[model samples]
Target: MKDVKTRAETLRRTIGHRVVDGKDAAVVTVSQSYPTDADDLWDACTNPERIPRWFLPVSGELRVGGRYQLEGNAGGEILTCAPPKSFSATWEFGGGKSWIEVAVIPEPGGYARFELAHIAHPEGDHWETYGPGAVGIGWDQALLGLGLHIDTGAAVDPSEFEKWSLSPEGLGYVRESGNGWYDADVAAGTDPDAARARADRTIAFYSGT
Candidate 1:
């Protein structure tokens, strides 16, 4: 099992937001380096069977312009696909449309760097309410699962892992991540007090603290 520190390091992801076409959208970016070929990393992300082992169980045509759904998660349309390098998709959920992109770049020693971004809807006061915490926490968990799945052909079930959110270690990580986002929110010129308060509520919700 991976230690809490290792998992926490993976959770040190970033969140960015902006208004696009008069709508508020949040983007969550997570990156990690793996000691695997770029082709293998790309396959793990794009392959249907392998994807569930790391990210979510996915079913779709998989080609560009194809529609796909993640088991119990978001469903979207594939926008672009460049094998062993990059892919983009339209992520639709909660009556909003977002975009996700994944990029894989080769490194020395048969390693590769994988980066993922999830862009959220740009509208309403939702950005202020849930922008940072939403993307930050979610991607943190996703990256953690990805690291595990890549190293070992196993994944923590989403449902079961959600329950772990209430554990002491889980709550601690949530609080820490929320605080990190709080800092980013303030630096981004968002109202720090409001962002911090929102983070508090979000932490409470996930951690049951």
Candidate 2:
């Protein structure tokens, strides 16, 4: 198993807002570098069969302009697809529509840098109640799973991940990830005090403490 703290610390996150179609939208960006080639990393993320091994099981048509759904998760239409590099899609969940883009960039020494950006409407209530951690933490966990799978070439047990999320080490990782997003929000012009408060709530929700 990987050291939770070290892995969590390695993740980079950014929480910012942008105006899309004249509406304010919040964006959460998570990025990490994996020890693999870009093509291999791209295959792991885009190939439906391989995705389930690391992330969630995905079904339906997967090509550009095709609709796809992750089992018990989000459903959306693929928007942009550039082989071994990037893909953008609409993320529809909880009766709301958002946007997601994933990019795999080649780095030196055969490392692949994975980046994901999730953009959605600013939640007046939930955003203040939980801040970016609600989303950032989720992505952080997914990135962790992906990194582990890539490094070890093994399927991560979903049940074990669920149980780990409640463990003390996992809770520590959650808190740290939440704090990272809180800083990002502050840097993006959010009130520091407000952001910190929401981060506290988010950490509590994920840690169950």
Candidate 3:
């Protein structure tokens, strides 16, 4: 693998989700500036042959309103596609429909700003039982993988990468992301303390704490 430039300095932000109708619906936004041209980054994301190198093996028609499937992963309808600038799709996973949008904006110095947003189901009894440390953490890892693949041209297996989510560093990431979710839950009018406690327990369960 090539030496990928570190984006830790520019990871910028992580915002958690607000609960809606007793369900834990959340959004995670991650951004990074890559030292590559916009077209290259765009192709990496939308090009079928190149997608599996960074994400999952995706097979589908490359057009708006086309249905596509990610090998062993989520499959959904393409809601929008604006070439090298934006792509939005319905991310159907675990019998639920969510939204994923990616935007690529060019910077002055041969760089591009990439932002990913995942809008998920809200917090509820089902969310509480399933735990708080689920989707957000997974998305965090996916963003990391995107960064690595863009910089190094190497792909990280999602399943293998998930194992790292249970490691010490991974656990820390989970804790932080979970706390963000809890905060968002509170902001959305949920019980803050209860949400935090539930999030902590979920982290512990995943981390063996």
Candidate 4:
């Protein structure tokens, strides 16, 4: 297993707010640079065959305007597609709809940065209780698998990773991810004490405490 502290620190998280279709929406962005070119990185993200090796098993017509679904997860319409660059889609799950944008940015030395932004409108007190750590930490976990796959060229056993998430070491990584999101929320204008409280709860939720 990878070191919890180092793996948790690999991704960068951020929080922001905006109006989407006249409703106040919160944006949670988690990004990390991968040791690959833009095309290869994009292929890993969009290819159904490769995605399941790291992320969830996905099935659907994966093209612009087509709908796709992740196994036991979100399903949504593909809004736009620009190969090797970015894609935008609707994230539909649990009767809630949100927007997601993913970008693959090329860096020098053939490196690429993968960025994903999930924007959701808070209807209840969910935002207050969980904050960005709610989604930020989840994405961090998925991206960690992506990093492992890219680095080692080996498929991560889904069952193993799932079981690991409930283990002691996994909980440590989850907590560290939550801490990072808490700091990001504070940097984005959330009150420190309040954000810390939310982060604690969010950490517990993911860690099954």
Best by TM-score: 4
Q: List runs of model 2 lying over 4 Å from the truth.
A: none
Q: For residue 9, give model 3's deviation from the true position in Å.
A: 7.9
* Model 1 C-alpha lDDT per residue in residues 1-209, reported as the tens digit of each score: 35655566544356677775677677777677877889888888888878887678888788998999998888989999888899999888777788889899899988888888888774677665665776677776676677777777676676666666666777777777777667766776678778788878777766755
RMSD of each: 2.5, 1.2, 4.4, 1.0
Compared with the true structure, what per-residue lDDT tens digits does model 2 show for residues 1-209?
Answer: 56878888888888777998789998899999999999999999998878988899999889989999999999999999999899999999989889999999999998999999999897659877887888899999899899889988888899998898888788888988888888888888889999999989988888877
Q: Model 3 over residues 104-186: C-alpha lDDT tens digits?
A: 99998999988887777753565665343455555555666777787778777766666866666666666665665566556
Checking candidate 1 for backbone clashes, the offending pairs are 23-122, 24-122, 24-123, 25-122
* TM-score of each prediction: 0.85, 0.96, 0.73, 0.97
lDDT of 3 at 193: 68
lDDT of 1: 0.75
In model 3, which regions exceed 4 Å deviation? 1-26, 121-123, 127-133, 157-163, 179-192, 205-209
lDDT of each: 0.75, 0.89, 0.70, 0.92
**Candidate scoring better on TM-score of 2 and 4:** 4
Off by over 4 Å in 1: 10-12, 17-24, 157-160
Better of 1 and 3 by TM-score: 1
Instruction: Name the 10 consecutive residues with the lowest summed lDDT in model 2.
Output: 1-10
Regions more than 4 Å wrong, model 4: none
Cα lDDT for residue 182, candidate 1: 74
lDDT of 2: 0.89
- In model 1, state the lDDT of residue 19: 75
Q: Would you list the rank order by lDDT, best first?
A: 4, 2, 1, 3
